[model samples]
Target: MKTYHAIQELEATGIVTAGITRRHGGVSRVPYASMNLAKHVGDDPNAVATNREIFFKQSRLTALHYCQQIHSTRVIDVDHTASATLKQHPEADALISAQTGVALGIFTADCVPIFILDVATPAIGIAHAGWRGTFAQIAVNTLTQMQTRFGTLPTNCEVHLGPSIQKCCYTVSPELLNQFTERFGSTIRKGTNLSLQTANTIQLTEMGLPVASISVSPFCTACRTDLFYSHRAEAGQTGRMLSYIQLTTKN
Candidate 1:
């Protein structure tokens, strides 16, 4: 599979591959615009299915496994067969797998989509973290699952925080901001701006992963409407971009 231009940092790793798709490469129009991979967002299902096919073909992934994503910290284990039945999988905010040829997918617009791959073991994980999920420590849960299921150490894992709404463009209500501060302490800042990226990083660091192994995308979906979808910028009327990663086998 040719590397996606948007996820150049992830491609540079050589060992694992990932992509944060843009809004240009699919067939959806207006509202959905293009490249809408989510089915529940009111986009045409046929368009979404075709878009998914294009994405899989472009990424060279065998199958795409997606979670229902309920803004919680639940994580599931996926294998080849599991990937095929992703439509029926329970609502989870994260997924982990040690099996090859299994692609784990997460959808996000303003929410964060994080991908983790263990260099020392054959495990991969994906997490969907909105403010709710971030405060719930979804990233930490994903790392813990990798450790427990595959015996992968946190230090051996490298994580990529895919494109999402950054703090600069992510504004929240005072009440919501206070909730974050109350739960996460100083991580939410005194102002009403809650940095979900920083919060997730701190959570992962607390789980024993080094800061150097974590790579965060600087592109904010709300700020870069030309390239990504933004739920807040569009007043919850936009489509979702998908961040996907998988362990592919050598044929």
Candidate 2:
């Protein structure tokens, strides 16, 4: 397995640099196996740092930004001045950046990872969307932050939906599924497996972004244990993948 999962569509866009991490190519114990990018998942700090260094060197990003990620809609801005060595990242689900050479990273096991880049500006963003964050409209709120701060327009934004547990292996309880269906219209279900990407796409399109502006990944983390990590599939004991995006600070 490769060290990263990238958005091929945005790679050609020149200013946007983005990718996600996989389970292979790192130094860690079983369950984490190798190449786990998150520290909160019981992986050794030194091992996690080594794995991140591999990704940082490969990506050529100047700085990296991450959040505590409490399944909330909180958004923050990261630029050149951000303290790269800070141990405690802000508690936020989404991070937007207008600085060059800075990367925004979101860690996930099975939840959706969404990357958004402004086609016309040097602005980029990454969001971690679990069912709670999605239902709370984190994606929408992230867009709103970009629009307000960077003057970004959704019409000119390219969105990438990274690997997550799809409807095939993601199932919720009857009461939870009923609640989601009532709020977001009937979910496209396979015995209660929720289509998170679909729900997010609906909200994005409703916010004036063209349905075609989004590029979705076909890989399901739950189904692809050989490559990625799945919290649900592994019963909450697993490593995490890093979903990242950046604006090349190169002048």
Candidate 3:
């Protein structure tokens, strides 16, 4: 496997291996560039399949379970059987699984990919948090599902907020600003700039997760255009990046 150890610090937790991918190491051209993992975003299907194969091969993950994400807060628990049935599963924004070797993958092109792992349990989760899903509290919902389904407590879980469009470049309309203020009041932002990272961290804290257990990547997708694809920076014509996490079985 052509593994990248850029996130080795996160791996020290002994429960999860998480990292954000750069726009390299796959088969696609120009607009889709390279390393694009999503098939529904107008990229060539063959190239997407090839990209997925390469991604799993490099990460050493066997199979990836995907969600038909609809920017909602709904989260589902995936087992070996549920992993095989993802093609027909409901459109949800998050996935949690204690099933080993079943990689939970979520697609994004600027939106956040939040990965969670419980050190006390064999559980892992991945979430797609766009502005809509973030505002709807998908991260909280994912953590709640983990506690409800796997008996994992928030304090025992470690979180990694992967690369996404950061507040440095994620400007929003007045309508979105007003809606955020109306819903979360002062907790969502410091000013006109809506800090999605802060909002997610706050949600995790409210769930009893320690402040030190959460880590946010400093890279901004929109700002670091050379490394990541950004939908806002590319005017809605960008390829999606895949953030995935899975547990390896003891065999």
lDDT score of residue 183 within candidate 1? 69
lDDT of 3 by residue, 173-225 (tens): 87897787786666666556777887788878988999999988888889887
Candidate 1 collision pairs = none
List the candidates' TM-scores in order: 0.92, 0.94, 0.91
RMSD in Å for model 3: 2.3
User: Following a full C-alpha superposition, what root-mean-square deviation does model 1 have from the true structure?
Assistant: 2.3
**Candidate with the larger lDDT of 1 and 3:** 1
Q: How close is candidate 3 to the true structure, as a TM-score?
A: 0.91
The CA lDDT at 73 in model 3 is 94
Q: Which ten residues in a row have the lowest lDDT in candidate 3?
A: 1-10
Which digits, one per residue and each the tens of the lDDT, describe model 2 over residues 49-91? 8988887777666567788989999988775455474233679
> Is 2 or 3 the stronger prediction by TM-score?
2
**Which regions of candidate 1 deviate over 4 angstroms?**
1-6, 80-88, 185-187
